[model samples]
Each structure stands twice: as structure tokens, then as C-alpha cells.
Target: MQKLQFEALRRIGLTLAVAQELIHLLEQHPGCIPVRVTEVHRETVRLDDGTQDLPARRMPSLARGLADQDDAVAVGDWGLARCDAHGDWWLTHCLQPFSALVRRDGDGLRHIVVSNVDTALLVMGLDLDFSLRRIERFLALVQASGVRPVVVLSKPDLCADMPRALAQLQARLPADVPHVVLDGRNAAAAEVLAPWLAPAQTLVLLGSSGAGKSTLANTLMGHAVQETGATREGDGRGRHTTTSRSLHRLPGGACLIDTPGVRTLRPDASEASLAASFNDVARLSLQCRFRDCQHRGEPGCAVREGVDGDRLNNFHKLQREMRRDTLTALERRQQLSEWKARGRAGRANLRAKRGE
Candidate 1:
């Protein structure tokens, strides 16, 4: 048996901890090969063993015994593969991911965007696609995923007033959340993002279409690895160029995953998770008089007094969405009457606060 280069595996973002985990799993299942899932499709998945792109499917028995979608193959997942007598490979078991980017869809089920991510490049074009609210949403999702976030404000050259735009973004965000304003098409991205893109690190680009994610991915990769598309002239919204989440080796030994443009990201996170993203608000809430204060008409509500009104509204809006998502369809239907009443009451409270 030929020995394997664990260094080759590290080039694909495999850390020493994961290597030991793979070794332990392989110890139990002899003759099984460890492969990283780079691309997952409807029927088949693409595997990378640090040597070649081996297209593989799940073993029939393994496929039948799948617990849920999480057990299904996905990019950034490490899987154990075994070759049959005919020499065809089949992915048998998926190893646990150290970190994962996940969100809840309208169905309220967790959708794992990408697994084993070290850093997330939260891209936002300085063009019409820019919004602080959207950035806040991404922050919640990233924080919940336990992945560090670096806000990449793409296409600075396109902004009419770069300083004003930057100031507005910096106002809402914390001072500690590092943000970089750059033209993603140029070579400067590799330098500006160097802190997170060191060798053996794995970074994922996350943003809406037309946010210059694919362009940055190509720039960092030192080639046109991911296809770039232009945003519409009207709204500056981009088309879906990268249709799936796929990982590729970068020029500097780190790996990058280019995900399809997301129209919306509903964080499948708890209120504490939401508060982690909005630390300023959370800190203010600690000063509130009541322990369970909702910040509406409550005395000594620091959140109402200190926090910006627009941010407060946004926080409440997301909280309502999360609460609604937790309810089942039947429960939602049953509560539709009281839900409308609460909406009316909430609006009345808002109006009262404004009139105050």
C-alpha cells in the first residue's frame, strides 16, 4: 500500500484536528478512503482526494438509511468512501463539520449552506445592491454558524460618494467587525483579505447576486476560475452565475467556496444568536428595567432610548419573522386571528412611541 501525503489534504483545507478525526474513523472501517466533497448535485456528488476529481454516488445501503438532508452529501463535507470489487467508489459516511453556514427557509428547516468554513467573506456591492439591513442579516447567520465574518464592500469605484457610503456602513456595524472597501476585479483583494486567506484556510464568499462575490473569488484564485456576471443597470442586482456551492483550490494553498447568489437569508438562529450579531442592542437591553422587557412602552428601556429607532424596528421585524417561522402551518392558521390582532397592536405601539 502506498502512503498518502497528508500535506496534500491540508492544501484542500484539511486541518490536523480533522485529519486525526479521519484517522480514527478510518481505523474502524479498514480499507475505506477519505474524500472531501467538493460539489453535490441532485443525483451524484463530486469528490476530491487531494489528488483527483472523483465523481461518486452514495452507497445504496447508505442512501437508504439517510437520517435527513444533513446526512445527504454536500460540498465541504468529508466523507468515507470504499471501493467495490469492480473498483467503483461510493461515499459511505459523512464526517462532522467543524463549522457550518446554515439558514432556515420558509419551511423552517435548517439549510446548511456550506460546512467546514473558516471565514465568510460577506460581500456587498457599493452599488444599488448595498444595504446595512442585509449586512446585519448575514452577520446573524455567520455568527450563528460560528464562522468569522469579514465584510467586503465590493466595487468602491462604482459608488458615487465612497466616504458617505463607507460612513453609513461603519455607523451600523461594530468597530471590531473588520470591513474592507475594494474593487473586487483588481489584485488588491488578495492583499486586503490576506488576514483570512492564509495558507490552509478555507473561506466562503456569501452575498446576493451582483455583489461581486464571483469576481473576488476569481481575483483571489489568480484566474477566471468562477464566472462573473454583470448586475442589471436598473437595480444593480446580479444574475445567478454560480449555480451551486463548489470549492476550488486557490493559488495560495487555501481553498475557496463560491456560492450562488442568495436573494434572501433567514437566519435559523435563536434570539441570543440574533443578539450576538447586534451586540450594541444586546448591551443596551442589559440596562432595561424589566428582565423580560420587549422594549415597547417599557420604562428605563435603554434599547428604546439609546438605540437608533430604525435599527430597533429592524430588530423587531426579524424577531417577528423568527417567531412566525417557529410555528407550524396549522398552528399559524389557528393563530392567524390573534396574529393579526398582535400586528395591529404592535403597529399601534409603534405609532404611540412616534407620537410620544
Candidate 2:
């Protein structure tokens, strides 16, 4: 009976690793039941117990324990819930996600977009929504989370010069990361994206508004599961038709999560992740004359010679942002003071050199 119950859970994206972890948790908590968090509200969360969806509230102790964490509970997270005497389910504990898509907000807080994602289908519209720099940012985020990323070039029909656009993307993107071009509204998307839609695998669609993430989800599911919207004629930017992140079961047995368009995507990555994402620049930096070459007009700078100017600039920008985010309040103030001191000293040295 337990095996049959687990088989049903497998249809909803329960893997061997997660099942093992749940078994351990069940051993610890005798009466608690394993549930997948489908949706999270302000005070309650909706969980799927493989058979049905139920509203569950977080225990006060559990909420307090995760108060300092980046997110209390994200979509696709598994948790252990227990029912009270009144028959209302209360989420007791949220299991740590094996993988998570996280991004840093402007306020320096980490925001988890989704959890336990196996593959990230980075949906970028081939129209006005296409940008290689933004895709690189997404790659960094996905790579840092230990999730596989496949670039999905959506709305290929809307592109004026499809060949040129694809050529530019291939030139900038990493060769190992697979990219596919297809119309999301067509039924053929399922066939085009079949390799990653295998049973028990979980995929998430991430892109800006009007990128056709929802449309692709519907096509893959063979029905209108998510609502679709039109993009602005002037800017080609789509409205936020999908407000919340939610998971859907595909006909192929894989789970798909659709998220709303993100306006600002600051990558929550480490230095190693940044280096791996921009491997080309990182490799070239080793050939520079100076070991710590900034690649800013420095003599014998191989990064500047080998890498594209714009891509190199974007790498430097992300590096700076990551450094700033990791700094403490006191460290930031001290760094500002040091910069002021250096500026004053540089001005004095100029006066001395000019005999002023």
C-alpha cells in the first residue's frame, strides 16, 4: 500500500532521493504526512498529497525557525504536515531543496524563485525581448543552483531575421548549453522539447513577460492550463499575465513550473559560479600580463583581446554587484572611506608632479 502511494507521488515529481528523505522524515515524525507545496499564500500554503490538494498552515515553531532564511517555502518544495484534532493540516517542517533558482533583489535580499528544479527552460522571446546579456545572467543563476539550463528561443515566427538572431545567440552562448527555437503556440513544442521532458524530471520556465512561457506550458500539456496574454505593440513587452509561480503535471510525466516575468534579475551567484558562467573570459584572464588584470586598457590584457567588449563589461558588472552584496555594512563604509582617501592622495600627487 505504501509502495502504491509512493508510485502515485512519483507521477507528481517525487524522485528516489526525495522519497528516501521523506521516509527518514516519516521515521522521525510518526503521524506527519509528506506533501508537495503547490502554492503559498500569506498565512497558508496549498499542498498536494499525491491524491488531492489541501490547505495547510505553517506551525509557529516552523515559521520562526525559517524567519531568517531567504524564503520560508517556495513552489515545488516538499514538506511534512500533520493534522490537528480539528482536522486542519499544519505544515511542520519544510525539507531543504536539493536545487533552487535564486536571485538577489535590489535590497540585497535573496529571493528564491523555485525549488527542486531539475531543468530550467530559459524562455526568451526571439522578438524585442531577446538579449544575450540577460540570458547570460540567467545562466549564471541556473548554474549556481546546480540545475541544468536549456535555452528556449520562443516565438520564432515573430522574429524578422531568424537566421541572424540565432547566429548571434549561438555566438554568445556556451556551446554545451542546448538551445531550441520553436513557436510555443504550436503543438510541435512537445516534440521539439522531448529530450528534457522525460518522466520524473521537473522543468521550470523562466523569462521576461511576453516570452511565451505560459503558451509553451499549455502546448506541452496539450491544453490551456495557463492564461496567455498579448505584448505591447510599441515595446513588445508582455503584461504580467502569470502572477504567481505554480507547478503543472505534463502528459509526459514531467512537472513544469511557470513564473511571472521578472523586471530585474540580479544573479545570486558566488565567485566560482560567475567564473564558470563566463568561462571564456576567465580562461583568457590567465594569459594577461598582470595576474590581477582588470582588463580595462591594461597592457597585455588577454581578456580584452579575446572577449567581446560588451560581454566582458557585463561580467565585470556582475562581479562588482556580487562583491557589494557580500560586503558587511561596516565594510562598505570602510571601502567608501578608502576610496575617498585614494582620490585625495591622487590629486595631491598630480599637484606635486605639476609643481603646483
Candidate 3:
């Protein structure tokens, strides 16, 4: 009976490693059963026991024990649940996800977008909503999470210059990263993205609002599973059609998670991850004369000479943002004081030189 149950869970994206982990967990908690989180609400989560969906709340102690609020729970998390005397299911233990897509907000809070996802469909509209910089940012975040990223250029039918757009993408993105152009509403989308939709695979659609993520999700699911909305005429930006993140079982046996469009995506990545994302700039930096070259008009700066000015500048910006996020409260205050002191000293020198 347990083997049958395990088989059912495997059909819903349970890997061998996770299954082994689950077996250990089951031994430790004989009263608890394994459940996969499908949707997470404010106070309750929707869990699947491979047969039925159950609305379960976290145990009070479980919620209180978590150090970070983001670690509480999220869609795609595999956990242990138990039914109480009142016939209500309660999630007691959350299994550590092998891969998690995380983003840090401006307030320095980490938000786990999705857990245990194998691939990220980095959806971007080919219309005015397209931007190479935004694609780079998404790529960085996906790579940081150790999830494979496939660039999906959505709404190809709506694009006026498909060739030019494709050319731009090929020129900017890494050659190894796969990208495909497809109209999400067309049935052909399934065929185009078939390579990544194999059984037991899990994927997440990530893009801004109006990027055709829902449309793609519906097409891939072979039904209207998610709602679609039109883009604004003035800006070509999408409306918030998907208000929450939810997982759906694809006919091909893979699991798909559709997320609400993010307004701000500050990647929760370290300096090493950022460097890996900007491989060209990082490689060039190694050849620079100074080990600590800022590449801002510095002598023998290979990065400044070799990389595109805009691309290099974006790398620098993201690097600074990553460093700033790692700083402590005291470190931030000291950095601010140093900046103020430098400003004051520079102003004084200018005044003296001007004979003030």
C-alpha cells in the first residue's frame, strides 16, 4: 500500500532522492503522511496526498519554530501532515527543497517564489514588453536557484519585427541557454516546449504581467486552466490576471506552477551566482591589470574594453545591489557615513581650488 502511494507521488514529480528522504521522514513520524503543497494561502495551504486535495493549516509550533517568515511554507513544498481529532489536516514538517527560486524585496526580506522546480520558463512577450536587460535579470535569478532556464519569447504573432527581436535575443543571451519563439495561444506551443515537459519534471512560468504566462500555461495544459488578460494599449503591460501562485498537473505528467506577475524582481543571489550569470564580464575582469579594477575608466580594464558598455554597466549595478544586500545594519550605516564624509571633503577641496 505504501509502495502504491509512493508511485502515485512519483507520477506527481517525486524524484528518487526525495522519495528516500520521505521514507526517512515517515519512519520518524509514524502518525504523519507525506503531502505536496499545491497552493498556499494566508492561513492555510492546499495539499495533495496523491489521491485528494486537502486544505491544511500549519501547526502553531511549526510556524513559530521557523526562523524566517519565508521559510514557513510555499507552493511545491513537500511536507508531512496529520489529521487531528477534529478531522482537520495540519502540516507539521516541511521538507527541505532541493531547489528554490527566491527573490529579495527592497525591505531585505527573502521570498521563496517556488520550491523544487526543475526548470523555469522565463516568459517574455515579443512585443513592446520585451527588454534584454529584464531577460538577463530573470536568467540570473533562475541560475542562482540552480534551476534550468529556457527563454520563452511569447506572442510571436503580435511582434512586428520577429526577425529583429530574435536577432537581438541571440546577440545578448548566452548561446548555451535555449530560447524558443511561439504564440502561447496556439496548440503548437506544446510541441515547441515538449522537451522540458517530460514526466516527473516540474516547471514554473516567470514573467511580468501581460507576458502571456497564463496563456502559455493554459495552452500547455490543453485547457483554460488559468485566466488570460489583455495588455494595456498605452504601455503594452499586462494586467494582474494571476493573483496567486498555483500548481497544475499537466497531461504529459509534468507539474506546472503559474505565478502572478512580479512588479519588482530583485534577485536573491550571491556575488558568485551573479558572476556566473555575467560570465563574459567575469572572464574579462580576470585579465584586468588591477585585481580590484572597478572597470570605470580604469587602466588595462579588459571588461571595459571587451564587454558592451550597457551590459558591463548592468553587471556593475547588479553586483553593487548584491553586495549591499549582504551588508549588516552597522555596515550600512558606516558605508553611508563614509559617503557623506567623501562628499564633504570633495566639496571643501573644490571650494579651496576656486579661492573661496
Candidate 4:
């Protein structure tokens, strides 16, 4: 069946295997139907392409799987959906993600915002929203996703003290990662992003709303494909402009997925990602007297002695957050196991009552 599907897809002009993977992913949903993703909206995904066999159709599907839901793949993910002969569409399953930016949602579930991305552009406006701690959160999430993360500081014109802001950013970020502070509204700035914007690569723009993600995306695509809005004056926060997760193909052969503004991001991180994100801290900690030194009031603690008190304090804060995330995940897992065990016990009691 898979071979035939591939052969059929080949007959059409769509030479990519991505759509096929998407179809397979959605097939896991028992009642889903195959639909081609032409465009996506905040609530519904527009499906009407030559690849789809259904009658010229555009129907509403649940955004539930796309939001704050565990095992739910985000935009840029291909899945097999169950949309029957009646034109109803239900997402059945998601394809295995090559890469994704995931964070813990309100329900304590891992939410995938963007998936199968080659690059994650961590957008931060050079204006008020710029903070090293916030950037660290994003870096933690990106590191957890196992994808390359590039930082782009937007709205350079708004910053009165550009040098100071840049200094702070530079101080927190490692020397190896690429970081750019650019005017999202400018064409020349788009050219500076050309290397990652090359053909065939897929990148996602992520930041708080009004960070100029949509603006940067539009500039790169050489067209106003997304809506743009001014930043809020009341608190210097950005109003939600790009309310949907949508994918666009650039003339340069790259693809970009613009996502809604994320207000709060929980670090659903792994130990490896935490270590990688805070490698400096890790390196310093290794020099401590005890192998398991907590670096707090421990005699001959090299980490405590060598690093600045403020910098060490920040590292410890990040460490505490990482540990908290791990504990939370463990607690959730334990509760789930307990619930399942109770269910099993109840089933056993019922079976015995039935005289097995």
C-alpha cells in the first residue's frame, strides 16, 4: 500500500516525501481522512490540492492536537488524517518528528510548536522584550529539541541604548552560536539571514508576539505573506498579530513556518540539553573538590571560588529550574503508573467476582 501511494504521488509534480510522511502520521487516528495541507489558519487547516482525491473541499478540523497536547505534532508535520467520503477531517496520528521545539503546556503536557525544522530562529526584539534569562529559556527549549538554534534580535531601531543591550546578549550567549541583531523590516537584514534561508531548509520563527517574526519572514520571502503590527506601548509588549501557524516557501528554496506568539515557555528539558545549554557551569562544576559538590558553602569548591557570585547565582537558578522540570516529569509519570495499577486492581476484582 505504501509503495502504491509513493508511486501515485510521484505521478504528480510533488516530488517531496514530506507529504507522504504526514499522511502516514495522520493514519493513526482511526477516523481521519487523507487531506493535503494547502494553507493553515488559527482554527482550521485549508485542504484543497491536486494531490487530494476528495471533492474540492475545505473543512474544519480540530486544532486540539496542534495545541498544548502531548504527542501532538505541530505545523510542518505531516500526518495521516481520517476524513471520510463525507468530507469530515480528523487528524489520526503524527509522523515521527525529525526535530521539534517542545515545551510543557498548561496541562503539564509537552506541546510541539514547530516540528521537523532544520533551524530554529529564536527571535527577540531589541526593544524592551530582550532579556538574557528569557533567551536562556528559549535556548533550553531549542537545545532539548536537538536542532540548531540561531538568535535574531529584532527592532533594532527601537533600542535607545543598542550597545548596552548587545553587550548583555553577548555576555550570556556562548561564542560559538550565531547571533544577529537586525531590523526585521529591512531588506538588507533579510540578506544577512541568507545562509540559513537557503533552499530546501526549513526554519521556524519563535518569540513573543510583536518580536517581528512575521516581519522577518515576510522580508525573507520577498512578499508580505503575513500580517504585521506595531508593538504595544502600554507595557512594551507585542500584540498578537500572526495568530496562526503557517508555512511559506521562499524564493531562495527554503521554507519558513511562522507561529503564534508564545507568552510562557516551560522548559521540558532533558539532562543532556541542560548540560549543553549551561556548559560553562558544567565545566566549572567539574573542578569542584567533591565529585558531587553542590557548590553551596562547600569547602574548596572550585566552582564557588572561581566563578563570580552573580554569574554563579544565575547558573544555580537555571540548575534549579532544570531539576524542578525533571522532578515534575517524574511525579507525573509516577501518578500515571499509580492510576494504571489501580485500574488493573479493579479489573482483577471484577474478574474474580465473575467466578474466573
Candidate 5:
């Protein structure tokens, strides 16, 4: 009985410590729940509890308020806020993240997909969703987010020859990284991912629909909390079963955030993510004849020579795409800045004309 008491106390203390750390990260926010946000109504949010309804005002997230509201906080973050005297909750702030999976918004602002993520399970089903280009895009996003990316090949049951598909994926991935192929509905699959399932840790699933992201989240939860759907026969794309981002506590004590599978993921690449994701390309670029060589039909393009022609082409293609995305984002920001400047100037002119 004494040992049991000690263990209970220890657990409580550990939980408190984790909470405190998050609070500090949130700049000592007063009233936020630890759970993720699913559906945000005008005044409330539907959490995973299925019974507990959270007041939207009480959930402080990065998406809450900022100059760039388009890049709002995502589902998998640890939030900070407090309940008022009336038992109403109001979100005040959110904990800063160690690493975040971000993508640009339609307005060209950066948006957080998942925050404080330790592991990003880059999921792709064995069916039509499996594409090297898509995987590379995810890799860039993972690299940029400063998180470890583990390729998870889901829906093994759907694939007639798992080994062959796995082999193809393996050949495409960077040699240094690891990949896991598993049936998303199986508990044994979670067991394979146990290394990352540490207590108080957070992991997020990043994959297209039909890759079994919702199923994997269910497996980790030891029950079904999310909806699952079948893939389209024409293209093998799964319907977006999870319309919103939601967090679930795993049976193993790890936290898992399952999000809606985006049809297109536009990445906001950093130099580090670029280097890490495309190490081969970066390494070869150093040997180029021209310092500013774009590697496009340029003579003495080291990147083209060092890597396989196909691999180099793909690398250049992604790099070009990232550059284009970045430029577009920058241009959007510039336009906003100019508009704001014009507003300020207009106000100043009005004040000057009104001067006595």
C-alpha cells in the first residue's frame, strides 16, 4: 500500500511538472486546456471527450490573434487559458513550440499545422496516394519544422505486394532515415512505434486521406474516437474523414494529433529543412562551377552530375517549387505591408490637413 501511494504521488508530480513546463512556454497563460481543438463554433469547441464542450474563448492557441490571422494555431498544440469566475473559459495564450509543422495559407501567411511535435509520421498508403513527389514535399515540411520524419506506409492489407511497394519507397527516401510499414488498425502497429510513444510526448500524423491516419489515431487511443472512410476507386484518395484537427491521448501515455488530410500541402521551407531534406542536392551544389547556378541546363552543374539524373531532376523540381512558393508568400506579405503603409499615410495626411 505504501508503494502504491508513492507511485500515485509520483505520477501526480510528473503530470504537474509537465503542465508547468507548458505553462511557462505559454508565457504563463491563465486558462487553456491541454487538449486540441476539433470544431470551433462561434462560442464553443467540440473536443475529443464527446461530452466535454470547451468554450472557444477559453482555448488559447497561436491561431487566436496575430497580425497574420490566416496562420492560426493548429490542433495538436498544448494551449494555455483559464476559466472565469462564472466557470466560463477564455483562451489567453498558447505555449511556444519546440518544433512546428507549418504550411503557407492562401493569403501567403504561415500557419501552424501541429505544434511542439516530436515525431512527424509521414504517412502514405500503398495505393494511388503513394508518390515520391508527395513524399518529398512532406519531407521538406518535416525538415522545415525541425522535427524527425518517419515514413509510415499504411494500408498494407490493400497492397497485394507490400514488399515491392515498400522497396520502391525505401529507394526514394533518404538513406539516413527510417520507415515503418504497418496496418493502421492493428495494435501491433502501435507497438512498432513504441519507441516514440514516451510519456508526455506528442506525435502527429501527416499523410493523405485513406492512408489510415484516423485509423492509426484510433489504434493509438485503444478505441475509435475518429471516423474512418473508404478510398475513392477512381483515384484511391480517401475522403477527409477528419474535418478538423483533434488530439487524443494514447493508451501508452503518448499524445497523438490527427488532422484533416489536406489535398495540397504548401510548404514554407527554411534553409535547414532544405539542406536536411535534400542533402544530396545541397552537397552537390557546393561543387557547382557557378556560385549562383540554378542547376537548370547550366554548364558544370555539380548537383546534376553528382546525383542520379532522375534524382537530381526531382530535387531541382522541389527546390524550384519551394522557391516559387516562398516568392509568392513574400509577395503577398509585401502587398499587405504596402496597403498598411498607405493606410498610415492617409491618416497622417488627414491629421496634417486638420492642423490649426
Candidate 6:
């Protein structure tokens, strides 16, 4: 392993331990080089091999192993790149990520948003785009990925009452979670997010369109690296200025992955994350009368008595949603299995009939 290679990779969010591991893994396969994926596109991906960015595509061997060929790459992923006999580069293999942030499609299929992210900057504009419910949804998603959530209330300069808005939003979040209010376009905004932008840390910005995610990315990078668009005057909803997820290095010595504005985010989170995101409600539930108290009409329902009525309702609603999703997924799997079994039986019966 060359010292320069390791140092350059480290500056781009590769840990020393992971670099050594990649080196060892590559040693077994001669002529293969280590590279980190910086941007993922429909047909090709851009990788940084600790020296320069290289555009490559997945090899046929690599594509065959993926359930969806399009899922062959994502931002913040580490992969092995090898030049074919034709001198063209191909991503040979992707390293298993230590962590990944995923969300569900309308049909409930999971999709990777970003990988190897340590922190999630959950941005919400303090204008018409602000909603505690939306924040909770984002929190559940981030918590599920085991990523630290930092609530960033953007465009506070536009808010009529920044302090009041900040306090109200903070009241709804977990007390331990860190948050900051700032104007995403201001240069001072970068300083407010400095703690999470330390060397080698990879942070992702998540928020609705026009929520200032792209602006924040540009401000943090200390340049106009990301395209910024104006939000609708009526609703304050911004258009999708960022069409793709790309990883950019920040002046603060960290990697920042900015995603396109997501209008809706349905979390396919675990029960633990659900409870953690709604810690207050979860705590009240523990004090309820029965171990399985629904808290709707149960006697001695601490959740009903102590928690805010709307928040409690939202919590219950999310619980029901997760349960429904789990059941739906199971039923879908079972239906597929039954269909396969019936087809097999039908073929078997046809063979028996022919024999008769």
C-alpha cells in the first residue's frame, strides 16, 4: 500500500482501517485497483481511486449478481475497479457497506439513497415547508440507518419569528438530538455545521425540494458547486434542482452527499427506530396499564393521558403503518410462493396425465 494513496483516500472519507482492508482484499486479486464511488448515474459511475476521478461501468460479472442492474452503484460506496484487456475501466466488485440509508418506493421496494454515511442533516425550511410530522418521518428513516440526525432549520432569515419557530420545532424532537437554525446561503452557515464536517466523515442532506439542501451543499463547499433553484411563491416548495445524488468534498474536510428534493419520504424503519424517534410516546407507553395497551381507550393509559393528543395519534398511526407494511410484505412473499408451488403442481399433474 502506498502512503500517498492511503492519505488521499483518507481525505475523501476513507478510514484508515477500511483502506487497509481494501488493500488486503485487492492483494488477492492482482491488477485490480481500489476506488470510491463519488457519483452514480444511469449507465456509468464516477469513482475516485485516491488519485483522480475515473468514469466506469459495472462489469457483466458484477451486474449479474445484483437484483437490479441499476442498483450496481451508489454514492459513498467503495468498489474495486479493474481495467479490462481493452484498457476500459469497470467496477469489478462493491465492498459491503458498514451502513446505508434506504427508503421505500410507492410499491414498497427498498432503494439505497446513500451508503457509508455517518450523519444525516435533516433540513427543513422554516417557511411553509415546515412540519413536525415531516421531521418525525425523516427522523425515523435516519434512525433506522443508525445515522446521527441533526435537524437543520433552513431559511430562518425568511421566517417572521425564527426563535419561536425553532423552539416549537425543537419541542417536538428528541431532546438529545442536535439542531441548528441558519440561512443556507450565508457563509456563516458552514461554521454552524462544522462539528459534523470533521475529517473523513460522510454526511448526507435530506429534505424536501426548496428546503435548501442544495444551497446548504454549496455554502458548505464554500462555492456554487450545487445548483440552487427558487421555491414557489405560493407554497415555498422548490423544484428538483438536484436530479442526482452526488458526493462532494466540503472545505471542512468531509464528504457531503446532496440528494434531489424529496417531496415525500415513507420510512420502512424497524420497531426500535420507530420507538426511538418518538421517545416521549414510547416512554408513556411503557407506563400504560397493560403490556400491549393500545392506548386508545385502555384504562390507566399513560400515553393517552400524558402525551400530546396529536403526537400520540401520529405515533399510533405510524405504528399501524409499519405493522401493515410488514404484513403486506409477508403476504406478497407468501402469494408468490403459492403461485410457484401451484405452477409446479400443475406441471406435475400434466406429466402424470400423460403417463396414464
- TM-score of every candidate relative to the true structure: 0.91, 0.92, 0.93, 0.73, 0.77, 0.88
Compared with the true structure, all predictions reach lDDT values of 0.85, 0.89, 0.88, 0.69, 0.69, 0.84
lDDT of 1 by residue, 1-356 (tens): 22345988888888888887888888778778788989988878888888888888887776676645445556798868877898787898888888988888777777788999899999999889988889988988898888999999998888899989988888788677899988898998888888888888989999999899999988888889778888899889999988999999998889999999986879877888888877888898889999999998988898999877877787887888788778988988878888799999999999999995
lDDT of 3 by residue, 1-356 (tens): 13327768876788887888888888888888888999999899899887788999988888887655547688999878999999999999988999999988776678899999999999999887898888989988999999999999998778898889898888778767899989999999999999999998999999999999999999988899888989999989999999999988898889999999964588988988888888888888899999999889889999888888887777887788788888888998999999999999999999999999
Report residue 120 deviation for candidate 6 (angstroms).
0.6
Overall local distance difference test of candidate 1: 0.85
Per residue, candidate 6 scores C-alpha lDDT tens digits across 1-356 of 22327667877799866776787777776678888899888789888886688989887787777645446467998878888788788998888787889887766667888999999999999889988888888898899888999999998767898778877777788998999988998898888988898999999999999999998898888888788889999989899899999988876679999999887777878788899999988888889889999889889999888877877777777776676566676787886799999999999999999995
Position 198, candidate 5: lDDT: 79
Q: Between candidates 1 and 3, which one is better according to lDDT?
A: 3
Model 3, residue 151: C-alpha shift (Å): 0.4
Candidate 6 lDDT (Cα, 0 to 1) = 0.84
| Candidates 5 and 6, the one with greater TM-score | 6
Note each model's CA RMSD in angstroms.
Answer: 4.4, 3.4, 2.5, 11.3, 10.4, 8.9
State the displacement of the C-alpha of residue 217, model 1, in Å, after optimal TM-score superposition. 0.9
> Evaluated with lDDT, which candidate comes out highest?
2
Worst 10-residue lDDT window, candidate 1: 65-74
Q: Which is superior by lDDT, 2 or 6?
A: 2
lDDT of 5 by residue, 208-272 (tens): 88888998888888888999998999999999898877666676667777888865676888667
Evaluated with TM-score, which candidate comes out highest? 3
- Candidate 5 overall lDDT versus native: 0.69
Rank candidates, TM-score, best first: 3, 2, 1, 6, 5, 4
Better of 2 and 3 by TM-score: 3
Displacement of the residue 17 alpha carbon in candidate 6, Å = 3.6
Candidate 2 regions with alpha-carbon error over 4 angstroms: 1-4, 334-356
Q: Which lDDT tens digits does candidate 4 get at residues 1-356?
A: 22225433322222356665545544444345333343444445544222453322222333444343435435665445555677566554445667778787555466667777788899998887876777878888888888888999888888999889887777777666689888888888767888787655778888888888999988987889888888778767888888788777676666678888875687777767877776776788888888988888988788777655666676677666556555566786887799999999999999999999
- lDDT string for model 2 (35-101, tens) is 8888777899888888888898989998888886646788999878888999999999889999999
